[model samples]
Target chain A: MNVGELIERLNRIGALRYEDWRAWVIEESGNSNPTREDVNAAALAWLKDKADGSIWLDPEEEQMLGEFLENVVPKHFDGSVVDALAFLERYGPEIASKDVADLKTYLNSPTGLAMIEKFNGHTGEQIGEMSHFFQQESNQDLSGYQVLRELEGPESVGNTSGSLLAAVTGIMPQQPDTAASAAPAPEAAHAQSAPPALMA
Target chain B: MQELPLAQTHELELIVDRRNRAVLLHRGPELEDYLWAQFDPEHNGLTLFTEKGEPRNLGLAIPKSFSDKLARASTLKLISVSERLHAGRPRQISLLQTTEAFS
Candidate 1:
């Protein structure tokens, strides 16, 4: 079933079996129908929506969606996956969550399957294809993010710099300050505050 | 200005040094003292560097407001990271307040 049909089915029954959702996704986003590329694009778009807060997500649901996109969804694809978790972790608050639950609901449906198929292939045989595709996209996104940062007005530069977390990941904790290394006392003090809470 | 209960399952504590215009994350005592990452006010950028000065990119869990605030402050210290839970699961409202009051 295509996303459209799947939506229709969902509306009629108010719910769907996993099998039904999968079948519809397979039919709609199959090798011959929507094509793996189309499915992949849709999946990325959906993820972008999730990242930018264009979709509805509760906190738990948001956490789960971040995990699925970063871990499970990448397992199905072949190329190096963009770190969806990192993006969400850093910029989650900036991206506005939708009032409706449609995005979360759709992700749990066959539409998700169609997106995963971009990398996993028909039977999970295709690998690297989706990963490589995403890797390229991530590179482009990073470049764009950098360009945007450079273009920001002086008044907004600080906020944009803070947004580095959203555009990139893997390097956190390291402040760009060389002087921080010279001052260990504040660092220790910060650590001191955490233990009591962490221990609890 | 607000006191928030820390999350039991939180992996890291986010702190900001407004005097230095930096952001840092405090891991548990079991971790190294220098494992924290800070935000660079000059560059308005945060890059993860280990205690050994090795550079890499690591993921962090911080509310968008916290990061945004880092750019505006000179010495705000993050006292504790807190969250409110729903259905036994944590919500997204993780709070990172400074030691000094914000007027």
Candidate 2:
């Protein structure tokens, strides 16, 4: 799908990540990118579409996200968010509150936080794997959940909270002889559904 | 501690719910809103905060009755109670897992 279509889908599913957008833009425009400007403008237009649009991120929510990103990105996951100010300032002025609130709410919601907490518990090798995965051209646009799904492959995808926890917990440093096609651990295989995606 | 009014209360919700599972969401965020559950299970609890290094007045304590379900995530239920019933007070939160998560 084209970028606009991609954005619409991401927005609808509440899976949009600023890092993904910036990565896409940087790759397309070759630096001196206008992603933030365009995003700010689009956000203004989206808010103008409806004062209470569900997708906008207000300052309060932005601060929450800034804190979240401070902890997660730049290390476990690589790409963008140099500092909190640069992180928070990307949106346009006249930004309505809480359009962003919805985003932050969903982003930090319990399940998301739970899964993120699992990712946070990764070993140095796991961290390396995650960083490498995000930096890949094919993986840049995928959400953290999507990356996990891919790593786990379709066979072991876990849907429930227990299995989700197991799904994440089940991830370990694969033995060199471990086949990528081999099934996930018994706990992972026990989970039947997929959990939600997280923002970056 | 003496009881006092909280600056922000009753702000979290479970946006998605299955019988045994639910997704936790932080709602009506203020500039101070941010969750620091990173050191949890080690620090012994996941705390949401407003100001950095300060967790005052941001009560997201889960009710013990429901917190047990969470211990069962290994067993695989969602570990949820009713968000409305449990999240109404800062003094507690409740996550009841039923071994039916992902159902």
Candidate 3:
């Protein structure tokens, strides 16, 4: 969509934020706030700049690295274009003969360890602790009643309190009978109403 | 339409993961919001967050309940709940899943 149409749609959905607009302009054009007349021209200029490799380190390398990470790596290991660019910025010159083992060696270094720690709040040792906790939890079986209790709605808090009161006072709450309260399906209702001869 | 900024006109699409029952919203390339069912293994209790990143309650009931039904399916489109429910809230979040979603 054109810029005008796009803006109207965003406003309708309440997704527009002033800060976001400002950031986009600053990134696209060096201008913090372009005049209304100049905004469209700035955008077109930004598009042209993006097409050439002026913003990124090298557009060709960026695309190649991004594609390799996305296609060859496991789905979970695949990262954003920003992530790829960051990697290239650090190791572009170091990537001699494009050896995978060299990259693996770099990952084992102190810098890589720090990056991994930042990825999650876990070190190599803490991840083990987390795995153990999940392993123990997964082994425990949940009873059907327990599952239902877990699934109870917000209104059940009051209902549970009322039931506790009834238990203490030796008076039963006006609860519907479990069997009788169950509603039959339409097909079942039709079958039940059929004559005995028809059933035979 | 009047000339508006690109950021102003961006649309957000919401989806729910079939497995793990996480709610995800996408606006542009970045800005992914995840709402998920968090089960406390220690207490055997369940708590669902309405949105990811500094979780806060949107004061809606159905999103918590419907999160269970969204399990084991492809990402379904999440439609906003009633606007009246979100009227006074600062963020104006609508949190409910629609029957239709993209596979």
DockQ of each: 0.03, 0.02, 0.03
TM-score, cand. 1: 0.19
Return the lDDT, model 2, position A52.
39
lDDT of 1 at A174: 30
Question: What alpha-carbon RMSD in Å does predicted model 1 have with respect to the real structure?
Answer: 19.6
Task: Write the residue-wise lDDT of candidate 2 on A1-200 in tens digits.
Answer: 22233234444543354333444444445763454555334433333343333355555544544544444344333423322122232221212243542434533667544433433333212211212232221111223222332232111111122333233323322211211211122212233222232233
lDDT of each: 0.31, 0.30, 0.28
User: How would you order the candidates by DockQ, starting with the best?
Assistant: 3, 1, 2
The local distance difference test score of model 2 is: 0.30
Top model number, lDDT:
1
Q: Which sequence of candidate numbers ranks them by TM-score, best first? A: 2, 3, 1
Error of 3 at A189 (Å): 45
Best by the TM-score measure: 2
* Tens-digit per-residue lDDT, B41-101, candidate 3: 2222222233333432221122333334333322222222111111010111222222321
Error of model 3, residue B4, in angstroms: 17
Docking class of 2: incorrect
